[model samples]
Target: MKLSPYFHDLRSAYQAELDDLTQDSEGKDVLRKRLAEKRKEIAFLVQMMELAPEMVAVVFHQGFRFARPMALEQLLGRGVDDLPGWSSLSADGAVVLEPWAASLAKAVLAEPGGERFLAVAAGLEFMQAHSRLAPVASHAEAEEDDGDEDAPEHDDDYDALSADDAADPHNARSREEASDNWLSDVGFDRKD
Candidate 1:
C-alpha cells in the first residue's frame, strides 16, 4: 500500500506545530533547520519502504534543504517531469487533515524539505500540553475578597504576615499565605 498519505499527514501536522512554536526570524530559521532534518529522515524511510513515485522519492532523498514539505509537493505538482500521479485516497486523506495541514503548508512553503519534521512534532505536543493547564472558576473566587468600599485604608502599625502565616478561623490568611494556600487548596502546582 502506498504510504504517501500518512507521510503527507505527518508532514502537514509537523508544519502546523512548527508555525505555532516559532515566533521570530531566528525561531523560523531554527524551525526550518529542523524541517530539513525531518525531510531527510522521511526520505530514508521512503527508500527503506521502497515506495514508488520514484521522482518524488528521489526529490525527497536528494534533499530540499530547509524547504517545507507542502511546498515541495506543490513544486512537484508544477514542474517535476516524472512525478507520480497522486491517488484519490491520498487526496481524501489530505481533506481529513486539512485544518492542521494548512498551517503546516504555510510554514514549509519556501524552504527545501530536508529535516524539519521532528521540530514540528515537538511544537505540536507543546501546544497541546499548554492548552490543558487552564484554571477554573472556584480558583478565581479564591483570588479576590469582597469588601465595603467606604472603609478607609488602614494606617495601623500592623506589619504584613511573613511566609509562615496560616489561614485563620475566619477563612482568611495574610496575602502571601493566602496565595500559597489558594494554590494548594486548588490542587495546582504554583509552578505550573
Candidate 2:
C-alpha cells in the first residue's frame, strides 16, 4: 500500500522535532527519558488496542521503568502534585506552551477541519505501521488457524459450489447452498 506524500512529510517533521529535543543542553537527560517513556506508552496503547493481554504485562513494565516521575499519576503517587509547576512540561526552546488549564482550553476550543483531520489520521496510520502495530500473521500461524479444531469446519459441498460459483458468476444458488446445505436443500442440483 502506498502512503500519501503528506504522511511522509509529517513523519519526517516529527522526527526532526524529536531530534531537536534531544539536542538541548539543560534538559537533554529529561527529554531523552521522556522519549523512552513515550515509546513505551505508545507501545502499551497499541497492545491495548489489539486486545493482546499476553503483551500487556511486558509493555506495562517498560511504561513505568523510568527513573523520574514521568507521568501525572506517578507524581501524584509521590505526593508531589501540589508543588508549583509540578505538572508542567518544561522544554528548552522558543516554543511558548500554555499551562495545563490553558492547554485544555485551547484543545477544547480548537476544531480540526477536514484536511487537518485527514492529515492526523494518515499520520497515525503511518506511525502505527512504523511502530510495527500493523498485524502480520506468519504463513505457519495462518495454516494453524485453518487446522485448529475451534475453527469452523469447511462444508462438504464447498469444493463443488466454489468451482461452480467461479465459473458461473450469475449462479442462482444461495451462499448457504454452496456449503453443507447443498446436499440437504430441496432444489440444489448435484453435478455428481
Query: Model 2: clashing residue pairs?
Result: none
| lDDT per residue as tens, model 1, 82-145 | 3322222134332122243333333332334312332222222322222223233223433442
RMSD of each: 20.9, 22.7
Error of 2 at 111 (Å): 4.7
* lDDT values for all models: 0.32, 0.31
lDDT string for model 2 (12-106, tens) is: 33333333344456644455565545444542333232222112212221122122222322222221113223113222211122232232223
Model 2 — which ten-residue stretch has the worst lDDT?
A: 53-62
Backbone clash numbers for all candidates listed = 18, 0
Q: What is the TM-score of each candidate against the true structure?
A: 0.19, 0.25
Q: Identify the runs in model 2 with alpha carbons over 4 angstroms from their true place.
A: 32-129, 132-192
